[model samples]
Structure formats: structure tokens, C-alpha cells
Target: MADTEPEKTAPQEHVHTSTDYPEGAQVEIPQGWMYRSRKLGPITFPWYASPQSQLVLVAFVCFLCPGMFNALGGLGGGGQVTAYVGDASNTALYSTFALVGFFAGTITNALGIRIALSFGGIGYCIYTSSYLCFDHTQNFGYSVFAGFFLGICAGVLWCAQGAIMMSYPPEHQKGRYIAVFWGIFNMGGVIGALIPLGQNIHTTSNSTVTDGTYIGFIVLTFLGACLAWTLCDAKKVIRSDGTRVILMQHPTWKSEFIGLWETLISDPWIICLWPMFFASNWFYTYQFNDVNLAQFNTRTRSLNNVLYWFFQIVGAVLSSFILDFPGMRRTTRAKVVWCSLVVLTFAIWGGGYAFQTTYTRAEVNKGANTPLDPSDDYVKMDWTSHGYIGPMFLFIFYGVYDAAWQTSIYWFMGATTNNSRKLANFAGFYKGIQSAGAAIIWRLDGLDAPPPYMNIFASCWALLAGGLIIAAPVLLMKIKDTVSVEEDVKFTDESVDDVVAHKIGHEAVDQEKV
Candidate 1:
């Protein structure tokens, strides 16, 4: 019995080798699991490594393109009012533009990601450049045409860019990435505003148009081309084994569009978050119109431009760091958003009221000799008195709020999707909502008698703020991590040489058993 107990089977050994399977062969195992092997090419790092960086660069180019166009508007000021389609009212111009934008933007949204991004860039450059062809001699029809083209271009570009930004990186990193992305992107406003300050050497009398503006457009267009190329070249890595699996080609629109919509609507957080983002865009558009208000002030075009740039820069810089504070860092996304909404309301609506009141009071005390009319339908400021303080504070406040809103939206997107293509399409849909809303508001402002400027501002602020607050809890409730089945895979250097490698080590013994 003791001799029988000493008997033992020969030791068992399992040997694994790379050549165990032929190149490009498919491997199948028990329980319906399958693996494939293919050699992976060298990984090429994109110009912008992370999605945040890609988004920021894209946003930056977007901001710059508009800045040049907007700078033209800044230079025109209140003195040279161009009629669009026989409608001289600024509200009408904005309204007509918005109406066209809504339709075109919606179509763009439906086009999904790849088509939208590609066509959007090409159309944007073509349409934006067309603005340079206009002269004072042109009929209102040209203005309408310009507006139509501009609206379409802007609508498409924004929708595409937003979707692209949403598609990048880990969920937790979304906040930080978006904050940096938007902060840098919005800083383009400062860059755009500064161009006018430097180029203002040619007075209005020298030429109806400034030559520098043409040069600026060229530069902006070139930058856009560079950004588009970078975006197209961005690297996507799928971690398999302990190594990264590089996906070299861009995603197809057909494969991703429906999936993106499904992911967006399926999530509880995104449903609530979408409307809030829509509100954020409306407010951002309103900020651009502040130039209209500023025109009424005695400040020179150069001075106003300087102020605009200064405040934007300060605001963007400050907001970048402020949102990272530990107390603010991990705060519920809803609360952070609500806080930003409050600040935005105060800065845009409340600040506008305060400034108007200040101007009105000054005008009355001065016996109306100041040429300042509180009832006027123009934007005015006392540049000498404030020396950019008013606009600075206003922009800084806007920058802070805008940064927060962008961060929350991106974070929400990252949490909801594993596919970047889907992120890009959803970004399009979300931004389309923004452009559509802005177009309507802008047009309505054009239609109002005396434009009820103050009342309109107040009303928009109230509605947006109320909407955000009410939606906050619902938006952030039960923020959960998305299901990423790909996370279970691991990759090593040897495995990186091949697209597919499967093995179970001592560490994976328990995992495999389970």
C-alpha cells in the first residue's frame, strides 16, 4: 500500500510559441471564444496626442476663423450698418441667418461625423473667404447670400467639431481635457481681437475695407487646413494584451452615426446634459453680440479690440486653473454647471443692466449733452472711464462659465461612448442644437421694437439659468461608468508586434478560471 501511494504520473508541461498559429490565422477555443493574429505596423503618434489636445486645436482654429470675420464686424461698429435682404435691422440679419442655419445645421447633424467634418471644413473655408468679395456697392441680396453661406458653414463646422471633441480619452479625464481644450480654444478670441487693434492703423476714411483683414483671413484659412489635417491624422489605440492596438484609418460615418445617436439618447445623464449644453451655446453667442453693445460707447475700434482681447485672455487663463481646485474639482457635475450658469447670468444679463443703468444715470445728470441715449438700439461704453475694466470683467466671467460648460459636456460624452466616431456625431447633434437656438434668439432680437435690449437680455438669462438649474440634478444623477468590454484585454511588447495575441499567465490563472 505504501509503494502504491508513491506512484506518480509524469510531470505535465505546456509550451507556448509565437509560431503556434500561422500568420493571419483565426484561432477558436471552447465556450465560443475566438482570436485572430495579424502583424501590427509601427505606431505613429498624431500631432495632437490626446483627444483633449485634438479638440483644443480644432476649437482653436474654429475660434480663430470666426475671430477674423467678427473682427470685420467690430471694425464696422454702429456707424456703418449694412442691410441684408432689404432689412437694415441687426436683429433681422441675425434672425435670417439663424433661420437658414437651423435648416442647414440640422441637415449637417444628420450627415453624421466623417462627412460633416470633411465637408464642413471645405465649405467653411470657401464660404468664409467669400465674405472678402463684398463691397459697399453690393445690394442687400449679397448680404443675405453671405449670411446664408456663413450660417451653413458655421453650422456644419461647429456640429462636426463638437462631436469630434466628445470622442476622445478616458471618462475621468474629460473634465480636465475639455477645460484645457476650451480654455485654449476661446483664447483665439483674444488673438482675433488683437488683430484689429494692430491693424486699425488704417482709419475708416482710408478705405472702406482694410487690406490687413484679407491677410488675416488667409492666415486663418491656413490654420484651419493644418488643424483639419491634424484631426484626420489623430491616432486611435485599442489596448490588447499589454500593448496598444493602433487604428490608422479614420472611422466611417455610416458605421458610427446611428450608434452615436443610440448612445446619446440611451444615457440618462446625456439626456439632461444636452439641453444644458444647448443653453451654454446660446449664452456664448450672446457674448459675441456684446460687441454690438460696446459699439455705443465712445471707445475707439482699436481700444475696444484691445479690451476684448485682454479680458478674454484673462478669463480663459483664470478659468483653466480655477476649475481644477480640489473643492471644485470633484464637485458634482451639476453643481459645477449651476455655479457657472449663475456667473454667466450675472455677467451677461445683470452686467448689461448695470452698465446700461450707469450710462443712463450719467446721461441724465449731464443734461444729455453727452450724446448718450439710453433708448438707443446700439451698444455703447465709456472707454475712458472704465479703460477695459467692464469688458474685461464681462469676458473673464464668460470665460469661466464657458469653460465649465464645455468640460461637463465633454466629460458626459466620454462617459457615454467607447467609439470616437459616435462621439463626433453626437457632438454634431449637440452643437446643431446650439447653433439653431442661437440663430432664433439672434433673429428675435433683430425683430423686437427698440429691440427691448435690456429686457431681452434679462429674459434669456432667466430662461437659460432656470433651465440649467432645473436640469442640473437630472443631468448629473447616477453618473455611472460606461460598459467597456475592451478593458479586460491586456497587451505586452511582444504581443504588440501582432494585432492579436492570447495567453494566460500565472496572474491570469484566477481570471481564466472564473
Candidate 2:
């Protein structure tokens, strides 16, 4: 609920309800559709999870297969996910994610978030279960089966997530809500890491993961799918103030594309951020799944993931506090995100050192069955890898780094834009590009050593470059243009019918211009 009374305001519905909007005009949405405004400067960090965050959390937990076990599934049969059938599926996943995401607003608008969530959830179920069966049957068919659906699901669910994240919370709490939403759902990574540790603890090495382990993934996958069924669509969402947000855009295909084109042309940030956003997930996938998981021993890898999730939560929570820290200006808050993400990029490369610490060596070989030499600098195992202490500590630290980088992206995207429909489009665009990045690496999985050979530092730096690219364009643009002055004013001095009408998106206004 708005903390203050509804001041006399312009009919916000007029933004959307205007029959005169040109083709592809962005309709104004209910206030409930926008994120809550903060009294303080730019960031919206809450100390605790809001009840409203359950949607993101539930969606995330159900997303276990995509980021969690399936990512690890590559470790099966010596990085089967990257090296063999999974390579094809991984490409399909992102390609589909990008393709579907370009126009996912239509899907959500037509079918609603529930169906998209369910479809995405079911995709996870199929992908997770199919991967297990493929591994069991050595069938290429199931691998392809899983990737296609997962890609489509990623496109749909992500758009839904963006809509809900921006809309469900109040302005002040939006940042915090995003933090909690992401922090909780990321627990899937922790759970995924733990499951393999338990299932494969007795195994000789990172050989074929046990059938029972696949069964575990299957069960967890379905549990997540069930949760998806329970999720509500964004339009129907009940906001904090107990008002139901009416349905926004149910754009026709042509209108959606036109709107998307208009947005891309008008918003410089969207164009600049696209490359980085597209490649975002790929770096992590290659580093953690293809490289780290491929190289480490079972116990060490397991311990690494334990650290990954545990510290990730800490990082996410702590980073949120940084966002909400009292007295910080909006620029300072953004800088915090930028600097942290940049530093974390180095930390990703630091994984090489961590990988070196393990006694396991490159458990998987490069093509031609090249010997995985523990003594060679390339395959050399480090004391950190050898010792549980080093691996655990790194995971914890990486968690914070991961938390800072990942959560910042979500919050940053929402904070900058108040357009619920555009926000959904942004989310879809981000994920679609992310899929493209992942797909590139899936192709290299079959190789003995994926691109840039052994220079993990370079790889991490590349990811940092992407993060920097994402931040650079936004910061370079004048602060006022990106963060509407009127929107900021609404935080404290809410006037009757004046500030908010201008503060929120004006696609309908754009339509007038058109």
C-alpha cells in the first residue's frame, strides 16, 4: 500500500486507457504495477524479505534444474553438458530464449504469467528428467528435448519475473524486494551443489553420476514445477496496499515488435546493455560448469558449491544493505554496484587459482584424450583445491561476489525504468542475450579446452568488460534523463495530481507524438 494517502492524481489509467494511442503505444499502467518508491536516494534495500518476494523465491526454487543440477549435470560423463549432447541443447536453450524473449510480452499478455510460469516450470521438469534419462540411455534425443523447452521457459519466466519484481513492491522497497527475491531463489544453487555431494561422495571420482543422483534431480525438478503451478500472473498480482493490478499490455505480435523497436531506438541504455546482458550467463556457465566442475574432484567440487550458495546468500543480503545504506546518493549506490561487479569479475578468474588448489586436476581431458597433468601449470592442482578450507572459503567469497553482481543487475534494471511493460521487455531482452552467450560456449564444450585456451583471467576480465559495458552507458547518460526528476520528487513531496503523472512512463504520450 502507498504509505501516504492517494493524493489527488491524474488518472494514471489515462496513460493506457486512451483509445487514441498509436500502434505499439506503451499504455500507462496502474500505480500498483510500478515498484515502490524510496524516500532516500536511488537504492531500495530492505533489511528483510517482504511477503511479496515469495513469487520470485517460489519461481527460483522451481528453477532448480536450469541453474542448479543441470548446470552441474555437465560434470556427468566428464562434462557431458558442455562436451556432448548437452552442447546442442544448451545452444537451443539460449537461442530459443533470445527468440521467444524478443516478444515474450505477447505470450504473458495473451496467456498470462501463470501459463508462462507453468510452461517454463514444466520445461525444467522435462529438461532435468530428460538429462537424467539421456545420461542413463546415452540417448541424444532427450538432451535436445530438454534444451528446447528450457530455452523457451527461460524467455517466458524471466519476463514474468521482471514484471512481478518491478510491480509487486512499493517504490521504497523495490530494491530490497529484488534482493530478497533473488537471494532466496538462488538457494537452488546451494541445494543443487549439496545433492551431488551427498550422492557422489562415495564414488571413485567425477565419473558417471549415480542413477540415484539423477533420481534426486528428477524429484527436485517436479517439486519446482509444482510450485510454478501455484504462482500468480503479474497483472492479477495483489500489491502491498491490497489493490489488484489490472492487466496491462496484451500486445498483438506486430504491436509488440514495433514497441520493442521504438524502445530500443529511444533508449540508449537498452542498446548499450544488450551485448553485456546477452553474454552475462555464458561466462559463469563456462567458468563454473565447463571449467571448474570439469577440473575438480568430487569432494572439492562439492565443497566449492557448498561455499557458493552459503556465501551467495550472505553476499546478496549484505549487498542489499549496501544498496539501502543511509545517506548514500543514487550515484554512490550505483557506483557500489559497478565497483563490486568489476571486482567480482576478477574473482571469477580467481576461480582458476581455486581450481588449481584441488588435487583432482583437470578430471576431464582436452580432446585427443590428452593427459590431464597435475604438474603442468595448465592442469596443476593448487593447495586451495586440495584443501577443503581454501575451496570453502572461495565459495563463500564468490557467493558475495556473485550476489553483488547478479542482484545488482536485476535491481539496476528495474530501478532505472518504471515502465512495467518495458520492464518485462527488458527482462526478456536480458535473458535472450544471456542465452546467446551460453549458446556460444555450448559449441565449445566438445573441445578439449574451450576458447582463450587457459587464460582464465582474460575470460573473467571479458565478463567484467560486459558488466562495465552495462554500467557505462547508463552512468554516461545524464542522471536526470535516466532517473526521472519527477519520480525522485515523488519519494518525499507527493503533490496532488502533479508529480506522479509525469514521473511514471509516458508511452501513451509517446503514442501521442507518433
Candidate 3:
């Protein structure tokens, strides 16, 4: 595990036939238009079967689901007239999400990625529809129920998403693949935010989003659910290098449960990641409710939401360049990202503190000092306000910090292993722990005397700083230059099928060539 030692690596085998594949394995490359290469003159389109293409598909899957979900979150109070119901719903959602996500990996392996992902896509429609119901009737219970149901579905959906996004790419391409996925996924946020910005363009008062907005979300999420069935099975996927993706035999229910425990024990260092995961979602309530909603009009909040997610794309792109910088050692890349995150965390949160000092949620609620109408004055910063640019830029930086933080975590997990099965479990644990922390914070945010905005800002800064500190030892000592097939094979119950053997000699290409 030391940084200087040679990392474990699988030996190369130059195979030339299907029979050469390890026995009892149907590891043949998938045959279909999507899986076949087409040459139109000199240009050859990459096969849809390629890892890069599959990763792009998976990214769109999230773009339609969680990407829209992020848009709703960014709208503050889920685009409702008040934050109370939204806060209550998120508390219920994360509570169930924490419990279900911990076991979703076992469910994913037993069900297979495609089936698990299909079920995962179903909950967003339900969650989005509940908001529509809330719009018609003042029923908080419906939103809470929808949130709880979506949490269960989200648990499975995200674990499946993480498995594909993390396990599909070659070692060096992990960061770029993650950035690609993040960019596409957050595009859902960007477009989803536009729905309300355009709808509420002339309305400056605090009010609920129209039925048209909720209906659009429901339709998009439903389509995203249907796309899950199109994903290639994990075992049949071949990398650009003609090596098969790493996956073991189909898992039995009992074996999956056992693998979950093994995933933890086999790599105890994963515990170091728990804190960072816990802190991952901790800032949402503060950024969404406290800053964007409390200080901006309805249309302005929508505009800021657009900018927030847009900058997230920018942030993901920048981090990928640093983390996947060519010819750098994986550990050195890890250190570089870590240092950058630490510096940004301090600088951005410090700005957040200064902004927090300028206004209190209580003052915003009562319309104490603003010159505008009481209905609209709960917000101080407006799209037309003279000093609006300062606070707007602060919120934008928050988005950038968020993307960088999340991309680094995914890259770290991908660096940790290449096995789809193990990566699935790792993804589940990450969501579980992350939701557990989110549940607590959301509950706190919903309280009668929710912690002061200042307290929320300080806690976010402390948790982020502390998480980096806790993660240092693992980054310094445990991360390897590369993951090997043998290490992944030991984590699962079955040995690797060595499915890389195949007579696709002409298709084999260097990683750079791809």
C-alpha cells in the first residue's frame, strides 16, 4: 500500500478466438448495430458498446433523473411558496435514503445493473408528481410520502449510476469520464431551471411554480426511466482496448449480502471516505434556502439556479483536467486535487461567511429593512438590484466548489477499484452515509428555531475542513498508482472470468489511440 511500491497489475494475454475465453463464460462481444463499428469512408464512429459511449448513456440517465432533481433543490422549497414543506419533505427523503442506500448495492448486484437502474428511474416521476399534487391541494403529507418513496428508488438508482460511471473507464480516463458524466447530468439542472425562469419571467413575487413546470419534470423523468433498459449488461461490455469490463458471475441474494460485508472488510480504508461523503451534501440547505431563496425574488432565484448549475459544469471540467493530467502519478493527482479543494473550501466559505453576516433569515422573513413590498421584500437581492452582482457571484462559486468536491470523490473511488461489483457496494455506502448526514442537517434546518444562518455557514466550513483532514491518511498511504484485476477478483465471491480473451485482435488499440 505504500506510495513507492509497484502496484498490482494483470498480465496481458493475446487471445485469438472465442474458445480462448475462460470456460463457462459467455463473454462474446455483443452483436448489434449499437455494438458494431460502422466505417463511412475514412471515419469510423466508435461503437456504442465502447466504455466511453456507455458512460455517455449513463450520464444522460442521471441528467434526466437527478439532474432535474437538483434543479428542484436549487429552486429552494422545491419551487413552492414557502420553505416549510420543502424542508419537511427533504428530511423524510434523506431519512429513508440513508437506510435504503446502505443496502442498495446488494440489491443492485442481485437484480443486475439494468434492472436495478430501471427501478431506480421510477421514483422521480412519483416525487415530481407529488409536487404537482401539492400545487393543487395544500397536502404536505403527499410531498413527504413522495420524498420517502423517491429516496428508496434514488438509493438503487445512484448506486447503479456510480457503478457504471466509475467502473467503465480505463484507469487514466476515470476523471475525464466522471467529468463527462457530471457535465451531462448537471445539464439537466441547467435546462430544468430554465423551465421556471421562463415561466415566471414577469412575476417578481414569492409564489409556487406553475403546473406546467411540474408536468415537464414528470415527463422527462419517466423517459429517463425507460432509457435504463437500453444499457448493456455489465459482463458483455468491452473496453476500447478490447478488454472486457471487470465483473464476476451473477450474484445470489445471500452472496450479495456477504459481498457487502466483504467490500468493507477487504478494504478498510474506505472508512476514511465516509466523512467526505457525509459532508458532500451538507451545504445544500444553506446554499439553496438560506442564500438563493432568502435573498432573491422568484425569477431571480431561477436565474441564480441556472448560473449555479452552469458553473458546476465549468468546475467539473476544470477538476477533470487537474485530476487526469497526463503522465502524472495517480497519488500525485490525488494530492493536487486535495490541496486545491482545501484552498477553495477556505476561500469560498470565507466569502459565504461575509455574505451571511449581511443578512439574517429572520430579517428576510419579516421584511424589516427593504424598501420593496412586504410580499416581495423577504428577498433583498433582486435581479435588478444595484448590488446584486456581488452576492450572485458568491453563489456561483458555491456551485463550482460543489462540482469539484463531488468529482474528486468519484475519481478517488474509481482509483480504488475497477470491479463493477465492488464499485457498486462502494457507491451504496457512499450514498448511505451521505444521506445520513443530509437527513440530520435537513431536520435541523426544518426546526422551529433552525440554527442561525451564521451557524449553518460555520458548520459547513468546519465539516468540509475536517473531512479533508480525515481523508489525508488514506490519500497519502492507501491510494495506488493503478488497480489490478487480481485485487478486484479477490473482493468478489467468484474469480474474474478473464473475459478479456477474444479474437478481436484488429480492434485492440492503445488507450491513447481511443
**Winner by TM-score:** 3
TM-score of each: 0.67, 0.74, 0.88
What tens-digit string does per-residue lDDT give for candidate 2 at 83-172? 455556676776787788877755665566666666766677677666567766767776776788788886887777766776556445
Residue-pair clashes per prediction, in order, are 17, 24, 0
Question: Which candidate model has the greater lDDT, 1 or 2?
Answer: 2
Once superposed on the true structure, which residue ranges of model 3 sit more than 4 Å away at CA?
Answer: 1-46, 367-379, 493-497, 503-514
lDDT of 1 at 138: 39
Give per-residue CA lDDT, model 1, range 1-514, as digits (tens): 3555766743323222333233543321212122122222233232223354566667666666654554444443222322122122233334443444334424444554345444545444444444454433434445456555555566566655654554444444455555555555545555665665556543422123354555576567556645555553423322221122222133344434444555456543555655665575565334443333333332354455445444544444454444334454334543555576566666566665665444332232232222222323333444444555765565445455555555655555555543444444455556555555555655553342324345555655775676566666654554443323242112111232333223222122111211
RMSD each, Å: 10.4, 10.1, 8.8
Task: Give candidate 2 regions above 4 Å deviation.
Answer: 1-57, 60-82, 241-250, 347-388, 452-457, 476-514
- TM-score rank order: 3, 2, 1
For model 3, state the Cα shift of residue 247 in Å: 2.0
State, as a TM-score between 0 and 1, how close model 3 is to the true structure.
0.88
C-alpha positional error of residue 83 in candidate 2 after TM-score superposition, expressed in Å: 4.0
Q: Give the 10-residue window scoring lowest on summed lDDT in candidate 1.
A: 505-514
Off by over 4 Å in 1: 1-43, 46-60, 66-118, 201-209, 232-257, 260-265, 268-271, 284-302, 305-334, 358-382, 385-392, 415-418, 448-450, 481-514
Worst 10 residues of 3 by lDDT: 505-514
lDDT of 2: 0.56
